[model samples]
Target chain A: MADKIFRVNMADLTTSIEDIPADWAGHGGRGLTSTIVSAEVEPTCHPLGQNNKLVFAPGLLSGTAAANSGRLSIGAKSPLTGTIKESNSGGTAAQLFAKAGCKALIVEGLPKADNWYSLALTPDGVTITEEKELIGQGNFAVVQALENRIEGKHGLLSIGQAGEMRLASANISIKDPDGSLRSCGRGGLGAVMGAKKIKFITVDPKDGKVAIAKPDAFKDANRIFAKALVDHPVSQALGQYGTNVLTNIINESGGFPTQNFTKGQFEGHESISGETMHDTIKERGGKVKHGCHQGCVIQCSQIYNDADGKKLTAGFEYESIWAMGADCCVDNLDHIAEADRIMDDIGIDTIETSVAMGVAMEAGVLPFGDGAGICKLLTEDITKGTGIGRIIGNGAGSVGRAFGITRVPVVKNQAIPAYDPRAIKGIGITYATSTQGADHTMGYTIATNILNVGGKVDPLTKEGQVELSRNLQIATAAIDSTGMCLFIAFAALDDEKCLPALVDLLNARFDLSLTGDDVVSLGQHILKTERAFNTAAGFTSADDRLPEFFYNEPLPPHNVVFDFSGEEIDTFWDF
Target chain B: MKISVKLFAYFRDNRFKIKEYDIDEGTTVGNIVDDLNIDREEVGVLMINSRHTNFDVHPVEKDILAIFPVIGGG
Candidate 1:
């Protein structure tokens, strides 16, 4: 069966299934979602309004026995950044979504009533149910209730009170195979979902019965791909240490973005470093090197445990550690872990909220390095929707505006992640020009600039940074559309055979003739569609810029500022 | 002369996270890494007193030198 698009319009509670448009057959994941949003939705409409749409799409190779190819991309006109957002994640939902033969699932329009609803997808069709019983619960409870409540073996995607309240930093939580939650956690698409009154989404596992076009060819390509992934030293290290391995290294490199971007290094960074976190996790009998989703070879995710050896969090990332630990000046690893768990349960983007905490700290709403106080702010104040909580929940930009804080590290109203752009010039271009706001995943130049995964580019120099960022952004857009985990890039960049193998996998899956150049075209096409949409939404080249403070404030360690001019950053769009 | 040396990420797996190293005042970062037995090819980034430095950079007295292996997540 040809994959079909399932459209749900909340205005009158209607649904329609349509065949995949010929033009859209080649696109999936970010490419598909961005294409649909750019073509179907009004770009200038308010993000949470009826005219805006939220789209979920599995990658082209999803659910087809492709290793590490279970990524799901969620696209929308972002409530947080007010730009085009394509936030992707690894979880069971993408596999199931594709297995059910869905090219894309689009949620459009606003519900007429104030009540909430839920949708369950079976191989046969989609069923919408009015569910008020589980409205205010967190993601953990939502996933738990659905098993007994809905009677199905399926993957779950849900939101928490943060989403229900339409917080700008809200994210949609997806249940992993182990019943732990992962997130499509950027750009506030959760707010759009909430505005449409979707409490949760479940796709039944039996619905997935996908067949690869050329089984033997796919098998051979996948074998080569998996070998490349596991053989790479970086992939092996990630499988062992998880992403938190970056904490100490980034901090030591003098680009950790500490204390709301006041400095690049944190005095208390060592306390929350990956080494310390790993030691504590080991002592607590926690499992490291776990995968957030099934079929992932490089398992950078871990199941962090508390003192009692109980589950604390999964997928505890380096950026979150930086945002909650160093950026906010709270270094107690346990406190940071608890905060990470809470952020997950509450369905907020960890990076945005952590940066919001930094903004709040700068406002004197909460003091920096106050571990207990930060927890209280999240649990007591933010959860209950107090005035301060609401402001912070609105995201870093709102918090900075409310408090008159000028040093906020945000571009296009979305907070930057762990890396200090002033210290690493290449990422500055990415943060400045990314259509999704200050998003690192949009163009992870760190691979080349810092990690030397692709090629070495001087982190402190302006030369090659723009070119590096542009190439990475294009490559990333293509990767996000492929349904494979981004970590594959570590292998693909280093081993020349890795990318061709991935292309072969896709070609085998679809029975087509695709080359490395075709992959590049796919990437370039997605970026162009997204940029055109952003431009239609009133994003001038002027909007593609870092914050003024990034230019004025010199981060210590390097004492360097984001020195790229508007003309230089604008060159990213020349593609 | 003594310079404060820090090891980051896997560089500290079996080694020290940080320590006071007794090196000559003009000792280069490459010399210190060699003394610590960290592979030169394995080092991704290097810094001195919070500023980015290369292996050829010789630390002054009281300098805080840090060595990091390749690491990227975000």
Candidate 2:
């Protein structure tokens, strides 16, 4: 392994390479990113301050051709929620970083100039280029410009105007195949990038291949994992239907957030469901499923098309559907598709943008289902940075506050995802206490063997939710550190051998023998470390909770309220 | 009494579309599972009146039941 760290100091436009920590070899990717951010960056520093650092690391199995293993984690203190944040994305960047023979990239210090610039990493070294010409360009345009300029095949991570303005809901876009925009679109990390005066980071690996320490064992483990994923029903559904498959299921369960979360079920879920998307793709002759990266076997991503069979977007996942569909009271799939394309181009968080629009409609700023009005508001008015556009850019919490809507569904200033916690109480717990606020990936309980951490509790029962959330959070932290996609949890839960096999593969590759228990312990430790950072940053148990509206309003279909007591919720992490 | 048994998604596509099963008084969800010839392990979420319920939970008369396979992802 190359024992080197690539460091970029924007203050002096200086770059250097240093030896990697001897202990960091086994802990590449998310493990390395989280550890470096937590240790090196001050927990209490302003998210956009010079004291903050953005660290990117690929996973332990990132370089190897492990299925769905090419994941890159961008970790720093989040501007949106003011918490420790790590957002993992899949594209070509992780694989490129691995091939570049570097474990991680640490971007430190704010730029001395007030102009836009970008850092390009290649086999030769790093170059700082003036990106002022690239300013005001959308994510796709910026990506194309960077690709053209870099003179080879490259992966570009760039932010749009939302990030430039330091909008709390800003996201960083990564290029997918056929040049569609996929993003790390949660937790305002793009604002942090904006603060650094860095418009984009382009990584190219002209070097032939990423060396693997144990190729045979890695291949065997990867094959087993691939087979398990292919055989799993959830994986099959995801591959076939994309994430929109959950639209009907969540609506049926009364957990699909609708009309700014005033109701749990949307009356028109079928119009925007996975089935509809699948049919649309078929009719339009679009690709139903494709990989986000080269070696991904799950292939849950899809190339969405217009009614006329023209390409509209790629990777139109469930959250985007929920945001534009039920949440905003727009059931027109084509309108939702257009909104998704706009979000991708603008480099913004779809969930936050949808929730903000919902709140705006509630405030009578625009009528519900006003897709054209929303399009104008986001694309045309937002660049002016005045009037309602400013409030919309601030995220769901800020918009809710501006509109005096107490029913705003958020935790730590970040809007909640598609799952309404009242209906799916297990996921609610995860949203409240997650290191990154209100995130579903923090603790995915979809297919896990419901660990009897609390008891056999009903989804509507509030009694055991805290403990459930806590347990899942710990498990998810460990999973994220592996640099593995959280979707693996579906197969890993039922196939008990998968987790052990993963650990075994890591151990063999890193020359260590780690037991399954040790893996669990590592997860716990990562959470504890994150929690300590949050605590020191002035987060109390009170901060670990869903918004107040959830406690009073009863969600539909089941009509259950979030009934967990404050004490029970507070005591959740005692374990 | 008879209750309607409906399977969705892969189950509907793969197995019998829909069927009416003659059930006894005080019949529970577990009994329905046994009667349908579906693997109990395959059922991840069971709903009656649009609320999630476990296998051991008893079904009420005239209850509209929907069974979903253990399918979930983000």
Model 2, span A218-315: residue lDDT tens: 77877787887777777887888887777877787788889988888898887898877887998998899988888777788998899898998889
lDDT of 1 by residue, A449-481 (tens): 777679888788899999999999999999999
Q: Name the top DockQ candidate.
A: 1
Off by over 4 Å in 1: B1-4, B23-43, B46-65
B22-57 in candidate 1: lDDT tens per residue? 887677889899988989988867878755678998
User: Model 2 Cα displacement at A395 (Å)?
Assistant: 0.2
Deviation of model 1 at A364, angstroms: 1.2
DockQ, structure candidate 2? 0.39
Q: What DockQ values do the models have?
A: 0.51, 0.39
RMSD versus native structure for model 2: 2.9
